[model samples]
Structure formats: C-alpha cells, structure tokens
Target: MATWAIGDIQGCFDEFTALLRAIDFRPDRDRLWLVGDLVNRGPKSLETLRFVHSLGDGAITLLGNHDLHLLAVAAGHGRLRRGDTLDEVLGAPDREPLLDWLRGRPLFHYDPALDMAMVHAALAPGWDLATAKTRAAEVQTALTSDADGYFAHMYGDTPHRWDNALRGWRRLRVITDYLTRVRFCRPDGTYDMRAKGPPGTQPEGYLPWFALPDRASAGTPIVFGHWSSIGLVDGHDVYALDTGCVWGRQLSALCLEEGRWVSVDCSARGSGAGD
Candidate 1:
C-alpha cells in the first residue's frame, strides 16, 4: 500500500482530483494524508469537504488555519473574510457533519514507525515529537468540548511564545498558532505571524521555524503545508507541500515511503496571498 501526503486543497477540487489521478491513487490500496486547508479560497468548498469526508479511512487530514476559520465562522465566532469562498460549505445540507468532522481532526499527525509527522504549520522550536503530540491533544480536547468558546478565543497572536506555565486559553492559543499559522519564529519559540513572505523576506531576528539551529523537532521527518510562498520545498527533514494550487499554481503530493513527488497544474485563482 502506498501512502501519499498532499498539499492544501483549499477548495480547489478539480486540481485535487487531477493530482490524485496523476498519482494513480487507488483508494482501496492507498492512503492519503492531507496537510489541511481542505476548504475556502477556491470555488468548491462544499464539494471539497464532501469528497474528502467520503474518503473515510482512506484519508487523514490535519486542521489548518482555514479549516479552523471555517469552524469559527460556523460557530458564529468569526466573520467572513473578503476572499472567503466558504458560503457553499456553510449553506450545504450536510454542513453539520462536515464541520464537526473537521473540528475533530487533529492539529498534528505523527507516526513513529514511519518516522514521519505532519502539521499544517510549524512544530514549535522547543517541542519534541512527544511534547508536540501532547500539546496537540490538549488543544483538540478544548476544541471538541466547547467549539464555540474555543473559536471565540482562538483569534489572536497573544502570548506569542510557548511557555509550560501557560494555561487556559493562552496555552491553547499559542499551540494553535504554532501548529497552524506559524511560519517564521525566534529560537525561543516566539512567533512572527505578520511575516507572510518567503524566507529571505522575514525579519532579521527571526528564521523560518524549520531553519532554527536548535529546533527539537529538527531531526524528525515532518510534512507541512501552510507556506504556499515557499511552495514545494523538500529539506530540513520536512516536506513543504502547499504549492499555491488555489492561486493558479500546482497541487503537489509526496510518496512518503519512496520520497517521490507528483503534481498537477492548477488554473483557478481564488484568493490572494497572506491567507
């Protein structure tokens, strides 16, 4: 059986299907690991959600910022953004099941036997695999238990760093930021959420999280997708898969065990940058 890890779909269902076809994906025998952002910004958010959800055990998706935003909006905690294409999803007849299923997805996915892990964004510089998993579970619990309350407090850059002493929403907020929206960060695990460009454009004091010299997760193989600006990078023990498919770029995927890569060109331009 083959295991393929795909980049953000972001409602670009046509390109997503094309990429799957290019990989010759056999749902009965192959497994797909999606690096989140399965909806929004493209034309078919509703179809995208249903297609992935229909995949059942054949697929696994981690939650990205867009996925969380969908939940927040569904819970009446977030406002529709200028470029959001989530109306189809919100108005769908199956919206409840789709949103609930999305909320249940983990913020991080790791398999020790395969020596692989996946997160929508960066793993905190200070977190090892075990600690990252535990922290993810903590946030997941809060998200599942009180989705509205969680969504209400989810929007922020506060407590911009991770601290063991952090408790309540502060701790969950920081963890959510790291696992979903992080790109550049200080070595101390403090985030630079405002920097949306590629590595060279980041502030002088910060570095791409994966580039940190002392990152505890450095040696662990990770698959992440939030940095579409960085495109399809493969290095630093991580595979960067978000190829800006929703922005007229290519949809990409990596064969985990073989380290092979495949992609399909996309023509849809749904949203602008800094999503």
Candidate 2:
C-alpha cells in the first residue's frame, strides 16, 4: 500500500481528482493524507468535502483554517466575510454531516511508525513532538466539547506569542493560530500573521517557523500546508505541499513512502483567496 500526502484542496475538486488519477490512487490499496483546507476559496466546496468524506478510512485529514471557519460560520459563531464562497456548503442538504465530520477531525495527526506528523500549518518553536501532541489534544478537547463557545473565541492575533501559563480561551486561540494561521514568526516565537508572501518578505525579525534556530519539532518530518504563496518548499525536515492550486496553480501530492511528488495544473477559480 502507498501513502500519499496531498496539499490543500480548498474546493478545487477538479484538480484534486486529476491529481488522484495521475497518482493511480486506488482507495482499496492506497492511503491519502490531506494537509487540509479541503473547502472554501475555490469552486465546489461541497463536492470536495463530500468526496473526501466518502473516502472514509482511506483518507486522513488535519483541519485547516478554512475548515474551522466553515464550522464557526455554521455554528453561528462567525460571519461570512467579503469574498467568502461557502454559501453552498452552508446551504447544502448534507451540511450537518459534513460539518460534523470536519469538527471531529483533529488539529494534528502523527504516525509513530513513520515518525511523521501532520498539521495544517507550522508548529511553534518551543514545542517538541510530545509537547506538540499534548497541546494539540488540549485544543481538540475544547473544540469538540463546546464548538459554539470555541468558535466564538477562535478569532484574533494575540497574545502574539505562546506561553504554557496561558489559560482558558486565550490558550486555545494561541494553539489554533499556530497550528492553522502561522507563516512568518520571530525567533522569540511571536507570530507575523499578516505576512503572506514568500520567505524574503517576512518582517525584519521574523523567519519561516521551520527556519528558526531552536525549533523543537525539527526532529520529526511535519507535513503541512497553509502557505500557498510559498508554494512547495521541501527542506529542513518539513514538507510544504500547498502549490496554490486554488489560485490556478497546481495540486501537489508527495508519496511519503517513496519521497516522490506528483502535481496537476489547476483550472478552477473563485472570488475568495488567501493562504
């Protein structure tokens, strides 16, 4: 059996299917690992969600920011912003099932056999693998327990840094941001959530999370997305699989077992866009 790590789908269902076909993905014999953002910002959000959900055990998906946003909006905790394209999903007949499946998904996934982990975005510099897992579970418990209350407080860019001493919603917010929205971050562990460009565009003191000198999770291969602007970067023991497929780029997939990559040009477009 083959294990393939695919980049963000972001509602680009056509390209997603094309990439799967290109890789000869057989649900019976192959397992797929998705980096998340399975819906939003591209055509066919509902279709993308349904197809992935139908894959059942053949697919393992970590929740991305968009996925959380969908849940938030569905729970009446967040609003649909300008350029948002999630109406179809919100109004779908299967919305509850889809949303339920998504909320049940974790913020992080690890395979002990592969010594590999997957998150929607970057891990904080201070979190070793064990710490990362424990912290992820904390946020997951909060998210699944009181989703309405969780989504109500899920937004924001502060406290800007992580502290184990942080409590309540503030702690969960920090963990969610780091795991879902982070890109450029300072060595001191403060996030630059506004920086969305490539590596050189980071603010003066900030660098890509993985590039930090003291990143504690550097020991494991963390496959992640949420940085479409950076496209595909595969070094420093991390795999960035988002190839901007929703922006008319390519859908990417990496064969983790063989370290092989496969991509297919995307043709979908929609009003919404971002990392």
Candidate 3:
C-alpha cells in the first residue's frame, strides 16, 4: 500500500486526476495524503470535493485556507470575492455531506507510523514534534466543536505572540491564521499577512516561519500547501507543496515514503489560470 502526499489541489480537478493516473493510485490499495486546498479558484471545485470525500479512510487531508474559506462562506461568515470560483460546491445538491466532512477534518494530521506531521502552513519556531501535534490539536478541536463563534473571529492580523492567556474569538482567530494563512512572522512572532512572494522580500525583523530558531517538528517532515507564490521549496525538513496549481504552473505531489516529487505541468493552460 503506497502512501502519496499530494500538493494543493485548489480545484484543479483535471490535474488531480492526471496525477493520480500517472502514479497508478488505486484507492482500494494505496493511501493518499493531501496538503489541502481541495477546492476553490479552479474550474471544477465540485468534482474535486466529491472525489476527495469519497476517498474515505484511504485519504488523509489537512485543511488549507481555501478549504476554510469555503466553509466560512457556506456558514455565512464571508462574501464571495472577485475571482472566487467555488459556487459549484456551495450550491451543490450534496453540499451538506461535503461541508460536514470538511468541518470534521483537522488542521494537523500525523501518522507516527509514517513519522510525518502534515499541515496547511509552516509551524511556529520553538515547537517540538509533540508541541506541533498538541498545538494543532488545540486549534482543530475548537474548529470541530461549537466553532461558529470561532469562524466569526477568524479574521484580522493582530495580537501576534501566541500567549496561552489568549481568550475567546481573538484567540481562535490567531490560531486559525497561524495554521492557515501564515508565511512569515515578526522576530517577536507577529504575523505578516501582507507578505506573499517568495522569501527575502519581508521587512527587517520579519522572517519566514520555517526560519525561526528551534522550530517544532525539526526532523519530522511536515507536508503543506497554501503558498503557490512560494512554490516548491526544499528546506531539508519541510515540503512546500503548493506548486501554484491555480497559477497555471503545475500541481505537485511527493512520495513521502521515498521523498520523491512529481509535477504535472499546467502551463498548457492559460498563463494565469490554475487552482
């Protein structure tokens, strides 16, 4: 039974299927792990969601920012923005089961047998393997519980240092941002929601989350998406799998068991089109 960790799908259903075919993925035998962003921005969000939901126990998915945005909009927390393309899902006939399955998903997932912890974004510095699992569980538990209030509060870009005393919706928002939208943080742990390009463009005193000192899950591989502009980066310990699927470049997948990368070119599509 092979286990493959695929990059952000972001609604690019065609590429997803092509990649699976290329890998000879058999749902009945092989397990598939996803870095998340299974829907949104691409042309076939509905198909993507359906395929993922059917994977059942053979699938491991860590939630991505777009995935949450879908839930938020479905729950009436956010409006559809320009360039958004998720209507097919929010208006689908089977939307209830899909959304429920998504809500039940977690922000972090690790199989100790695989020795890998998966997330949507980078882990904060100074957290060890245990801490990664613990903190991820903390936020995910809240999201899975009575989290309507949590969704209402999961916006903004302030109150940066992760203090345990952080209470109410504000705390939930911070944790959500960390697990979902973060790329870089200030030296003191302030999030940079504005920085979106590759590394090195951040202001002084701000550094990418992976660059922080004594990071959590130091040697354990963390498969993640959510930074297409960041592309595929190899930091020796983390896998940046958001290979600009929505940007007309390519969708990527890594065989974690062997640390192999396979990319399906989306350049055949329009220059600025992908998921």
Candidate 4:
C-alpha cells in the first residue's frame, strides 16, 4: 500500500479530485495523509467535507485553522468572515457528523515505521516528537471534553511563546496556534503571528519555525502545510506540501515512499487570499 501526503484542499473539490487522479489514488489500497484545511474559501466546502469524511480510514486528516474555525462557528463561538465559503457546510444536513469528525481529528500524526510526523502547520521550536504528541493530546482532550470552553477562548495571538508553566485556555490556544497557525517564530519559540509572507519577508529577529536553530523536532522528518507562500520545500528534513492550490497554483502531493511529487494545476479554481 502507498501513503501519499497531500497539501491543503481548502474546499477546492475539483482540484483535489484532479490531483488524486493524477496520483492514481486508490482508496482500497492507498492511504492519504491530508495536511488539513479540508474546507473553506473555495467553491465546494460541503462536497469536500463529505468526500473526505467518506474516505474513513483511507485518510488521516489533521485539523487546520479553517477546520477549527468551522467547528468554532458551528458551535457559535466564531462568526463567518468575508471570503468564507463555509455556508454550505454549515447548512448541510450532515454538518453535525462532519463537524464532530473534524473536531475529533488530532493536531499531530506520527508514523514510526516511516519515521515521519505530520501537522497542519509548524511545531514549536521547543517541542520534540514526544512533547508534540503530549501537547497535542492536551488540546484534543479540551476540544472533545470542553469544546464550548475551548472555542470560547480559541482565537488569539497572545502568549506568543511556549511556556511549560502556561495554564488554562491560554495554554490550549498557544498549542493550537503552533500546530495550526504558526509560520515565523524566534529560536526562543516566540511566534510572529503577523508575518505571513514568503521567506525573506519575516520581521527582524524571526525565522521560519522550521528554520529556527536547534529545534527539538529537527531530527525527525515532518510533513506539513499551511504556508502556501513558501510552497513545496523539501529540505530541512521537512516536506512543505501547500503549493497554493487555493490561490491559483498547483495542488501538490508527495509520495512518502518515493519522495516524489505529483501536482495538478489549479489556476481555474483558485481564488481568495490564503491564511
């Protein structure tokens, strides 16, 4: 069986399917590691969610910021913003089951045999694999057990650094940000939440999270998306698969075993700004 890691879908169902076809994906024999953003900002949020949900065990999807936003909005904690195309999903008959499945999805996934880890965004400089797993579980527990409470305090950019002493919703929010919203940060693990441009555009004193010196997770190969501006990076023992598909670029996929890429052009489908 083959394992393919795909970049963000972001509700671009047609492009997603096209990429799947280009990769010759067979649900019965291949597994998909989706780097989240499964819905939002594209033309078919509802269809995208339904299709991924139908994949069941054939796919392992992390929860991206968009997915979390969907959950938050569904739970009445977040409001739909301009350019959001999630109305169909919110109005769908299966919205509850879809949101439930999404909420239950983990923030991190690791495959020991492959010696690879996946997250929707970047890992904090301080978190090694074991620590990442533990921290992820903390948010997962809060999301499942106290979603109301978690979502209530989920949106923020404070506590810009990781602290072992952090407590309550602040702790959960930072953890979630590292896994889902981070891009640039300092070697000290302080996030520059405002820098969203490609490399060389980060604010002074900041480096891309993966480029931070002596990152604890540096030894293990990581697969991640969420930074579409710096598309398709294969170095630093990490694979960045977000090729800006939602922005009129290519939808990319990497074969885990072969380390080869298969992409589908998405110029026709791309629209809206990427987060």
lDDT of 2 by residue, 60-167 (tens): 998999999999999988999876779999999988998999999888999998889999998899998888889889888987788888999999888989998999
Ranking by lDDT: 4, 1, 2, 3
Q: Which regions of candidate 4 are displaced past 4 Å?
A: 269-273
Which candidate ranks first by lDDT, i.e. highest? 4
lDDT of 4 by residue, 83-191 (tens): 8899999999988998899999999999998999999999999899999999999999998899999999999899889999999999999999999999999888999
Evaluate residue 265 in candidate 2 and report its C-alpha lDDT on the 0 to 100 scale: 92
The residue-by-residue lDDT of candidate 3 on 1-275, one tens digit each, is 78898888888999999999888899998998897789887899899989998989989888888888898898888788877888999899999999989988888788889988788886666556676677777767877786676677776677766767787777767777777888887655677777877778777787878777666557887778887777788785888888887778888888888878888876443443122
- Clashes by residue pair, model 1: none
Question: What's each prediction's TM-score?
Answer: 0.98, 0.97, 0.93, 0.98
Residue 160: error of model 3 in Å?
2.5
lDDT of 4: 0.92
Clashing pairs in 4: none
Q: Report the alpha-carbon TM-score of model 4 versus the true structure.
A: 0.98
Query: What is the total number of backbone clashes in candidate 2?
Result: 0
